[model samples]
Target: MESLVIPVLILLIVGAAVLLVARAVGRRTAGATGAAAKTSRGTPSGDPVETAKAAAAKLTEDQHRRLYALIAQGQAMAAIKLYYEASGEGLRASRDAVGALAAHPQPFRSAAPKVPEHDDDDAPERFPYRYRAIASKGDVTREVSSNMLNDEIYGRIRTLARSGDTEAAATALTRHSDISMKQAREFIALLDD
Candidate 1:
């Protein structure tokens, strides 16, 4: 038993060293290959949240307000059309953009950027509006609604979906909402469209 101690200690130190080296190599490789992977895989490079924020910035204050109003009213298709016409992006891209905006609400930023006056003086709770996402295939339909999901988080999920990482997207969806993996998959399937 005493003879076994030295070898076991050596093995533990070697294992820890190997793990540390592997993690360092993984970080280096991931940083070096991230852009290459995005380009090769046909996913847009750079931070998607910044990209989506830039896209949102293209909208004027009035257009931004109107878009949010449409989303708040739950007129998703109409909101998509509004964003399509406003952004001059393709239909599919517009759909994704609208979905992103809905999941993560952006306040209007203009030269002056006036805050829209609200009459609800009694309402104490502001921010974190619940957004609903609905997806259906064949006769099966699934809906996920959560206040925790925002445009930035949802944009990441959309990026995962666009990059053929449905499993990751589903995992993200499950993390953002109180849904099972199966339900998250169903919702993520709709996002790919």
Candidate 2:
């Protein structure tokens, strides 16, 4: 009976220690998650516009949209590079800012600078210009050449590519061209870069 009592006490002590450890670990994890959530949501971080300005002071309205688009497409590295170049910030700061921006998107403060007044709304400039985009992987090569696609339009398409919405991007590409979905997919596949 005495031996039983000692063994039982030891078991209780071990169980109590385990419970204490688990509770401590849980509290630590919970605190960390809270901080992460706060960071991602931009609540504890303060006003989003200020954050955007501080992180990317030189980002024009169009650049801002394209950057966010890249983030949406899950092109973290490209987004970071774009931010870094646009903001003139170091790589690390750009990375952290990009991470936060991707987690919580911020709208463009003002209207996207009006598309230059065009005689035709669908077409920009006085005359529609033909632009060519080529993507090559292994031995397979794809080219998308269309007068309907300008830098701004292609930027939109590339943004869709970065955000991992190749289908939407492909659809947009086809809409801009006479190509079939298969050709659009082939072209969009090269656009991932």
Candidate 3:
């Protein structure tokens, strides 16, 4: 009996030590898994809006439009798949990005700058392709086409017209197009909206 007591006590001590070690290991594993799960779930470390914007920047204009349309239609899985194919990212990454994009609606921002760095406001740049500006009022329709009149220039002309600067807008329109000042004024008058 005395010999059995010593062995039993040693056995109990070893079992307790083993239990403690196992618990320590389990805690460490649980902590690691918890952190990994958080990251895998697409938890953003920074501003969610900025994160969403960054994800949106990866997509092209068409992709952006389709993704948003899918999101708007409440087709999350389709949106994710579209993003996955369009972005060529891992499935997990695409899922996260799509989730972020869905949570925060973002406007499509073009990869290239809208305005040129050395753009001269005084001298309108001529584009390779001719841009056509059309205006309709009731039964009458007018059109102005010119290589120097892109969307930006037309937008400025419209802005000037809307801001009660019809003369300036007409002048700008004449400068950019082959239309006469009287014709430019007539075109500017139709751009009420």
Candidate 4:
């Protein structure tokens, strides 16, 4: 029994270390990109990891899960609203939270297109917005005017985005941005930017 004790202690220590590292990796990888991540950043000087972890910890389970889903779809406002609704504790607090959500809105990625990296220095020309779609269906074949990138549609898109319903937002934007893959990405850029 005494001889086995050392190995048992070693096993416990290894398990604890593995758990700690796993938690750290999970916190970072689980995060929503762009706006969701940025919104929780602790000032310019604060520790980003700490800030994000704190924010995630603060969220209730449902709001946290919804927030993760919504941020992916670029619906910052709706996510914020949902977060407030779920976590505000009571009626008056929740109502006040709604106003807070309206004022602050939700987060989104910036408007800049990610400039693709190159290996050889041939000086990459700025490629135009090429359409990118992993999948598409339904009546999204038609194109709409670009002017639909206005406030009203943006608000709708924000709501849709929070719900993780990009298709609906795309459909709405299609009423204004012409629904091609490039146009869809562009419309999202316009609204999110």
Candidate 5:
């Protein structure tokens, strides 16, 4: 029993120390944004993602959408490179700036484990039905996938709206709405005409 107490106390102290350090660091950094990473608000200077976002604000709608889409793919660095390639920014600077933002990603919190309650059947009942907490990992994955797809679809739509002919934009929108490629050619024709 005495040995158990020492080990448990040591674990608690270590855990508390770690939490305090993480919180301190987190407080200094930007809150939960993939962009805005570089230096924390308390630290020295501005980061690349912020700079890119600023530059992006000046871009036409098509470029803007593509930039964000690539960002969603964990390719913030690639997005920066593409922009620099297409625009005047040099490759190294853009890549470095974007890559800095990508590294040291925001830590993710895993769902908490649920503890089940045991009810005595013979004893006096406090309530009615058994409230079982349910969580499906598949559901979480599906939801994330759906969100990603939606972001891509919107990004593509923005691109089409900004550059493609009216018929093409309409076709793209229609195709995206269906989640299939059916009638895409006809819609493309509409844009052409």
Candidate 6:
């Protein structure tokens, strides 16, 4: 009975040590994972869209287009370089910004505040080349081609649509293209994303 007691006590001690070691390792691992998650999120709020928006706001329209083009072409290094140069930020910051931009696509938003007077304008400036804007919902697809519509104008229309100003977006679209109000509304509806 004495011999059995000694062995049982030793086994219990070893088991407790193993459990303690496992718990310590688990806590360390979980702490590391939490830190990594926070770093990867890149924002204190942990909202990827807001992070992307803030990063994108640092870029010009041309830079934004080129960066997204590079990303779309699967050229990560080029995108990072472009962002680094355009933003005048550190390489690490550029890399993180590019990652956030790629992960959550953001539309170009002008740094200047939008004027209500400009928004109320009924005429759209004519561009040298015809711009094509296409929108699709499910199986239905719509295309609007016009010399009066360019990237900037289309972007503004899309922004309006996304901001829940469907009437204004449709009005802008109708002014830019030959589409009627009803058709413009239908087209704007598909741009709600």
The candidate with the higher lDDT, 5 or 6, is 6
Off by more than 4 A, model 4: 1-45, 86-193
Candidate 5 per-residue lDDT over residues 1-193, each given as its tens digit: 9979999999999999999999988876646443543332222125554554445434455665665568779776668877676556556545653454344232223345895663222322223323221113322311111211244444554456456554555454443343234444333333332
TM-score-based ranking, best first? 3, 6, 2, 1, 5, 4
Q: Supply candidate 5's per-residue lDDT for 7.
A: 93
For model 2, how does the per-residue alpha-carbon lDDT over 1-193 read when each residue is reduced to its tens digit? 8879989999999999999999999999998887764433243444444565555445678888889889878888899989888877667667777776766666666544776554322533322678887888889888888877777778988899979999999988887766899999988888786
Candidate 6 structure lDDT: 0.85
Q: Rank the candidates by lDDT, best first.
A: 6, 3, 1, 2, 4, 5
Best by lDDT: 6
- Collision pairs in model 3: none
- Cα TM-score of candidate 1: 0.34
TM-score of each: 0.34, 0.35, 0.42, 0.22, 0.25, 0.41
Off by more than 4 A, model 6: 44-51, 72-74, 86-96, 110-193
The lDDT for every candidate, in the order shown, is 0.76, 0.75, 0.85, 0.51, 0.48, 0.85
Worst 10 residues of 3 by lDDT: 37-46
In model 5, pairs of residues that clash are 167-190, 167-191, 168-191
Worst 10 residues of 1 by lDDT: 118-127
Better of 2 and 3 by TM-score: 3
- Between candidates 3 and 5, the lDDT winner: 3
Task: Candidate 6: give the clashing pairs.
Answer: none
In model 3, which regions exceed 4 Å deviation? 1-4, 31-54, 107-193
